[model samples]
Target chain A: MEEKDLVILCIKGNRSAQSELVGSFAPRLLSLIKRYQPKSLSPEDILQEVFIEIFRDLKAYNPEKGVLYTWMKTIAIRLILKTRRLDQSWLKDKTVPIEYSDAIPDLDQILNKMNTDDIMKLIIALPDGYREVFNLVAVEGCSHEECASLLQIAVGTSRSTLSRARQMLKEQYAQMKIY
Target chain B: MENNRKDWRDRLDQNESPMDMGMFWNSLESKIPVQNPGKKKRRFLFWLLFLLIGSGFIGTIIIFNKPKGKIAGQTEQQKNAGVTEARESSLSPIETQHAADEIPTSDATAVISQNQSSSAATAAGDSVHKALTKYQSENISSVTKTANTSDKKTGNNSNDTQIEETASSGNASPIKEVVSENKQDQVFGIENQNIEKNAMSTAHELAQNSMAAMEYLPTLSGELYRELNWNMGYVPTFDHAPKLNQEKSGWQYWMDLSYGIGMAQHAFKTSDPLTQSYLGNRSKYESTLESRLAVWENRLIHPSGFYVSSGLRYQTHITRFDWSKEEVKIEWKLADGFVQDAQGNQIAIRDSAWQQYREMREIRQHNTISSLDIPLNVGYIIRKKQFSIEIAAGVTANISQYTSGKQLNFQEQPVKWNATEELTYKKSNTGFGASAMFRASWYPTEYLGVFIQPSFHTDFSNRMNSGAGYEHKIDFVNIQAGVAFLLFREGR
Candidate 1:
């Protein structure tokens, strides 16, 4: 169905249309939550919360502006960022492992052997500050300045934090010995 | 070897693992608040519709149950009142008697109408009364004047004394001429007594003859024809006479049940030329319906032969086609696999695939579609003493339809494989159409009868669009035979 039609039906509380929306986007949103890997909440629980918020604010949605997936992704990113601020840990700046920084490990070879779950596991091992900064900049492809704004930090810190996060992923990759 | 970092972003964005969609929907559906705006409106409409239909049914029942009393009473009262008014407008017998009794009581000769009996019956009596009134006043004044003069002269006899009393009652003055007339009146008065007896006899006879001849109208207490019961047919027109018979007038009810043989004409079309060709000869009118039945129909008949009827009708449509035996095949396969040991390390391996097959040929597929409907009809009846004929037209709305059979596609067929595996015949509850009917009935008893209604029904179905651009129209004829029970006698 067209997104306009789907949104109209969802607002009218059509069960089939609401189920269709949930079915089409549930796994993608769950993957986004898994990427954040919140230590306190299950990915499914967080995904449920995301859909609740989506339905609660469905009237404000305008299909003409952009597609639903892009809008939903922004909502998930903002919600994860808000959860991180509650811990107040993502605000700290972590030092890049200097000995390893000389060799920014080439991860493209190891990444080829890995599925997204394994890659996520490697990402999860990094410190909270490095992981948040890396997910915002390197994975999500946000500019260093935008990452600093969202994380409430300086551009210099985001740049340094991403390097540390990538270096840590490399060390974890070597330890796994999959390459 | 190095890969573009953007490649990982694309792969991660496409990170979809097949999950149970129903499970996720169920888990999330509860968290979403339902905010349908029409819920309250729909509920209010439901109650309003229910109340309207319920009130209509109850009102119909009460109207039908009311015994047919007023039709006869009201008609009789109106007719009688008209006759009475016409009688009163003219001088009736009792009024003429009252006019006759009003003349001078002491003098029978003053029953003066008999001498002019030909002109003095009822209408002429009014003129005669006026003339006598003048003559009595003149004679009394002359007597009074003569009595006063005779008092001035010699007042001798008792007869003159009575004359003075008549005069004194009028209080007229004495006159000389009145004295001479007093003697003449005394002799005339004696002669008037003899004549009065004969005049009274003749006047009484004349009054009786006129009373019997002209304006003796009858009321309800008088003999008129009796009102007929409901089952009897009404006369179209009757002659105007005193003995005219009145037909009963009121609302009556009849219960009817019928079974009919109906033929359905089926038409089907499609936008897809290929599907059309394949579906060709499949949707043809394979055979007519087995039977159509209608029961518990109540007809409310008006005295003028117009009626409204409503009932539940059930119809069935069956599709049968010739099927040739053909082989149907099913296949299965086992792919190459590696067996794992205790530590989850593969130890055994296979390098090839296995295939299995099963086959059979099945024949003869059929489907039956049955529908229940409520039909409302308005008709006019032509009836005699024992039989009635009615012609009517009306609409039938579908209450429900049920189909209890399956359809299949043949593997070895003339057409190539199609995406749709089965023909989906969808039916809806809102089907409505009109019909024309001609019914004839024979009553064996006063309250029970049998009837045959031959009907032509045309149903236009917008609900037939189960496939792309498919439309169907059905024309059927039903020759229905049934029994009828008459109820609620309009009048007696």
Candidate 2:
């Protein structure tokens, strides 16, 4: 009956309604995939694979989380991460950690405390171990113990690395202020 | 520093956050067009329809094919089977039905005693016991009344039975008088002539009309049979084996192979230093032995007339340990002694050298026991169709003390400990004992029936003489639930 209502029913094993659901959301999901990986795979190719995966595991998705577009977006992100991790050559050479955060704050607080332009530069400059722990613990607000377990490091190392990242940030902030 | 770090942490969080979806999806509406929406609604209704139809079909089949005998109204034939053949045979149509409806003791007794004399001669021993028990129980107080009448008048009691000739009067007095007459005849031997005369008449009845006379036959029309049973249960009392009984109901003949997995602890003194040393300086080590059996006929109680099953039972005990030693090793560094080494020359040594070396020798030991038992039992069913309850009891002979398999493993290999040493086994003079089992099954149809049996009995083997090998007695009490088919049921 309704656009959003139609996609929800299609995802719940209503076969005839699925084409409508895919046509509406497939392009946006593909574009989101393009942001994470630009040229390795086509948006159309990734989108098709994502729809197949979604259809196969439709019952597993929790509807209460968000609307159809947001739900499709989350599935695309998980599949992208999975594809990259499983490609041994890419995994070995890339050595990069995915980043995500749960909090949204005022632009003033971010800029005054650790400005976005400077913060991005600092993150790009930090060493692999330091950057990974910094992103997970500081940016993502994960516990130091959780970061250690996920990164396969000692809790003490996680704490010290996070502390060092903050120290470096403060030094940069101080230097920028002087300049 | 803490506030600055918290602020920096909060600033880092803003970069990795997800987009606000409420506004994102709304903005993208014009970019994506709607797809076909009609066909999807039709499919949902189909699934609902299929589930409803499938469940209804299954419910109908179940309703039509309900376990027929599990819940059926007791018919006249089924209820009449257990009405005591002796009572049913003596009473005419009106009397039998009346007595069966109401268990009037006097009328029922008259009907039972009328046919009791003929049945008694051919009945199995247990049937006789059951009849005696039922008679004693049902008419104990009434029998006391007869005791005052002097056990002399045997046939005169028929006058009391004739008081109400009509069967519908619910007259139990006639049945009671008949039983009393038989009792009188037996106690005073006054009517011994009449009983002999009836026996002759039966012989004549057999000659004149064999088939008609055979109509309520007392003797079991089947052959003698044997059975062996194996049973196991936890023995709460130390004085005896646990009670393991079979559930009685219907033709119950089971050939079971049972094993008793038991653990027993014993404390005994040992001079072996290995066990003594490891036993925390204790003089004796309390060791436990586990027992097991290979094969045993747990139950072989054959109801009279057609079954035979015998098998061997091998039993043993096994023990397990984490750390054990056969001998203890101790290194003693003794003080120098005034003794010659190789050559007989006096040597100057410290005063402590004269101290003698001392070591305690110990050896670890374990014990295991095993036995082989073979029992042969035989029985026969009495009063075929006339008796609803098939009562059987018999004796079994311990045919073989040694079975085919290895008896027990003590250390590593099986040892014939009992065989190696000369044993004066207290051989029993043919072990004799009895068991009683009652089976009653009501078959409403040719293929199915409801069988119920609540039975209990015990077995007795001669007291063995290892001194420790006392009599092996096993008792069984069980209730079995199963469906049986009459391969060939004899019908009149």
Candidate 3:
């Protein structure tokens, strides 16, 4: 079925539509949570929380305004920012500048391999600020200005944080490669 | 990194997180009750309605069924008036006046009567009057005023009843015993002398009074107890206690079997001109068959033939809407050449009914509603020796209602209609309704009375639609026949 129709069915409390929604979106939502609030709750609890919010906010959900996945992703990101804002450490860019290196393989290249679980572990091992900035810029495609506004920081700080996040990820990738 | 954003998004979209789907669903299912929050509120409302109706019915029965017999604080006066009126009817005014001057005559005369014959019963009845003259001022005055025509018979039965009442009561007045004690020693020979004087005076006054008023008393007093007995039973109507002649005042229960025809009024409120043109008529009656089952209906009657009644009636009403109206059939269907997804699931849905047809139809539809009705009535009875006619008007409440059958569900979302689509009717709150009933009852036996009551009853209600309401009323006239189980308390 069409995603919009599935959303409508979920809004109508259709169990199949609800399960399909959870099944289809769990991996993306879990990846987002790993960048935001990985250690706070289990992966299962985080998905439950996100899906519950999605179903409840279905009434105010306007399918004509945006795609369902974009809307759901926006909601999950907002919820993460709300929890992460309580710890100002996540907003602090403590990492230093680094030079570009060759150890960082393209994530798309690794996904084409048999398994790419080590790349997710490398991202999770990064500091909160770098991971948040990296998720927004490298994964979510938000502009530097939007990332700064969302994380309550300056555009230059957002840009510098993204640079530091990529260099730190490259170091972690090199270490994983050596191991 | 901007170019890598697409690869990262694509990889994340392709990846599937491992989860306990069963546990996650169970957790959500636990919150299903909280999702639909109105169920709890509706249950509370149902219980509250039940409690209110139940308490109201119980309160009606308690208020209307008052205990009967005996006027409080007026017992002493009744006894005095009863004895004095009986006494004055038997003797001449001069003789009653002479006997009453003696405060201790009744005991001696009662002794004399017990030892002698029925002639002595007449003389003892004079003593009964003489003993009462000091207490009953109005009756004594009425007796004295009517003395010129005092040719009524002796009060032997009244004396007997007075003795019976005095003997039965543990709290009888000391004055009766005090009078008896004063003449306790004079019970025999001299009492006979007083008896002779009373008997002679009785005959002389009977002649003089019969010549003036009651001609029948000459023969009655001429023989006393042998000719005249139980005549004091009628003396309660002597204007001293006219309340004694009042009608039977108690509660009665009647079971009514009613058949009624209800004229239906569909006062639809809609901006849809098509619906307004179709359903806004009050043209004819919806053929109705209503069977009314009245239970615990206790009727409280007053001496003036006015009564108040309250009860519960479980009435099943079958109403038919018989008329022909033109209706169009509509269905929602996908247009031709609509695309399907890779999964072969239909990717598009029809937004509105595009496929339609027109048809002429006759709607001879019927619906039944069983309601628990609490009806209150005030009526007057014109009672006869064998039968009675009652006229009553009151308001009624439909406390609990259950409805069945299908009608035109104009309240449906999107106003969709198919040729065979029929929706269940929702029960509505009908406030108080005005009703008038005329009943005629014939009591062939003492404990059972058969009655036929014809009534015009109207029920006012708002037919609910999508949380708004429109006026819909039903007016019916019915005839009911039933047998009433009569429960008459004392003082009838």
Candidate 4:
């Protein structure tokens, strides 16, 4: 079967195609979801849930409008947010807001020091607002205007918030001397 | 079908997960098991029973009301008989009884009108027939004058007749005198059989004309016949169609209730960092929605289409930051069942210890802003082959307000704080907005038009002053791309 046909079959409850589709997209979606939800969930946990949601919403996909990959990616991003939002036990125990700064990383120190987990830790350690803005604008690469539209804030608010989030991250790196 | 799928695709992108089709389907299948045959059969049975009961009740009502159909036919026959009887009779009962009732009435009116000439009475009688003839002639002008006027043009003729008749009725106060004389004449009533015959013929003709007039009036005229205009099909010619004082362009608008994850960055300074703490200063606000409506003129069928709507958007975010550190005494139970210092990595129980103190916070913010906007657009329309382009700029005068709640939780105890503040995040003014739209109209039939319109607009006044404390300066843009089904057009 063609890829589109296989996708259609998988959406219609075909077992083998579904397995293959999950394996194909899981890694990337896992990473993306992880960037948004580092502390509340593990990448593995989010990846499993993303697959489950993708299956549930398969019948809703339409091939005529756009490519399946872009469609699936958008869904993964949204679901990662919705499910993580439900488990808000972390809200009661928040960290302090990092101060803003501007500096460059030391290439040698950074290469040796920071792993993905440490970066995830720093990201999650940001104040809730800064972290969310960072994920949507910087990590997801949405335009400032689009980010504001999604976040229901003024465009300037979105821009300033994103800038502050990036600044805070730089300050954290400087404090940790990872850069 | 295509539109449905497109909408579904958009919603899916906004709400679904990011998994490949294979894994998604498997996960769904595992999570949502297929229904059993027995349950399906039972469901079918229930629906079938519902349908049977509903149809049976409707059938019973239809049967009960069946008798009214026969009554309708009988009433129509009775009406026809009554009209025929009325037309055949030489005189109405009112005229026959007039002689007996007019004795005293004529004593006053006859004495008064005798000074008026007998020929004047004849002239009055002639004028009444003239009025009745005019009523009949215009009433049936469509049936007879078909070559001269179309249906709608000739339809107005009846209104003109009614107006004239009303004018004449106001001028005929003298005729009641003669009628009163005839009423008092008792046995002398049979003296003018010819006159009576003429009058009866006039009445019969009037009845026929009235019935014919009834058939040509529009259905809306039935109520209006008793109310304003007193004639059928008159008011429709002047229905409420407000003409635009100026030229306009085509426009479109949208209000999206979209929820996604985003961050808020704010700074706060504590007097003493070691003593004061910001648990997880992040605030979780949910149920935020935004709404907008706009109208455009000129290029599309509407010159500009006006629309206003509102919707909600949500996002999931986990934000954490450390607050304050405190040094204090600690007590704990150890698995080793030994008493020792807790800080040295060997103690089962200790009176006090020092450790790195940190607090993490996660906040979800939902922002809902209700906005009311009216945009007046001026645009130009350009048609090229099957495509039409309308470029217009508008001024959307907007009034918006926002309310937000922040919940601070320490150890899972909810501390809620609410604040209602106008989001002065965008510039407030007689906001200048503009729209550029490319519309393609495909007319496969004379009465139907299929159109796809893509439009973009931006408010020029983008400065937002949050009173004295916070001010945000930014530009706002609105983009919409959609298709429409236009029913009937002016041109054939």
Best by TM-score: 3
Candidate number achieving the greatest DockQ relative to the actual structure:
1
List the candidate 2 regions with Cα displacement exceeding 4 Å: A1-56, A65-129, A148-154, A168-179, B1-177, B180-492
Task: For candidate 4, write residues A43-127 as lDDT tens digits.
Answer: 4544665565455445556677677776676666655543433333433332434333322234223423455555655565566
CA lDDT, candidate 2, residue B94: 19
Calculate candidate 2's fnat. 0.06
> Which is superior by lDDT, 1 or 4?
1
lDDT of 2 by residue, B1-492 (tens): 446556755544333323343344344332222221211223233334334434543464455446334213222222232223434443222122322322324322221122334222222222323333344455433321111222223233533322211111122211112222133212111112133233333433333332332221211110001000000101123223211222332233332322222222222233322222223222212223344433333233323344433445344444321112212222333332233334323243433212111112222333343444453444333322222333334444434332122222123212212212222333333344343334444444443434443333233553332332123332333233333343322211
Candidate 4 regions with alpha-carbon error over 4 angstroms? A1-3, A42-45, A64-66, A83-128, A148-161, A172-179, B1-29, B32-492
lDDT of 1 by residue, A1-179 (tens): 98889988988889899888888888887777667753334556557767765675576566776788867776667556655644556545434543323225466556656777677666655666777877777777788877876776788777777777777787777776654
On a 0 to 100 scale, what is the lDDT of residue A19 in model 1? 86
Candidate 4 Cα deviation (angstroms), residue B363: 29
DockQ of each: 0.11, 0.03, 0.06, 0.04
The candidate with the higher lDDT, 2 or 3, is: 3
Per-residue lDDT of model 1, residues B1-492, tens digit only: 335566676677667656677777788787575442311222233334335534543464455445556544643453333222422344222223322222122122211112232222222222222222343344423211112223332344644422212112124211111111133232111112222333234434323343221121111101111121111112222132111111544445566666765444555655432233223333443224444554556666666677787877776655433322222222333333334445333333433433221112223334466778788989877565566676778888987665444444343334322222343365654688887776677777767878876666666664454433455555555566888776545543
lDDT of 3 at B433: 75
Q: lDDT of model 2 at residue A23?
A: 54
lDDT per residue for candidate 4 within B30-106, as digits (tens), equals 55322111111122433343355345444643553464444345334432232223323444221222222322332
> Could you give candidate 3's per-residue lDDT for residues B426-454 as a string of tens digits?
57765767777666777776566677765
How would the candidate models be sorted by DockQ, starting from the highest?
Answer: 1, 3, 4, 2
TM-score for each of the candidates: 0.31, 0.30, 0.33, 0.29
TM-score-best of 2 and 4? 2
Task: Please state the Cα-based DockQ of model 3 relative to the true two-chain complex.
Answer: 0.06
Best-fitting candidate, measured by lDDT?
A: 1
List clash counts for every candidate, in order: 4, 40, 0, 67
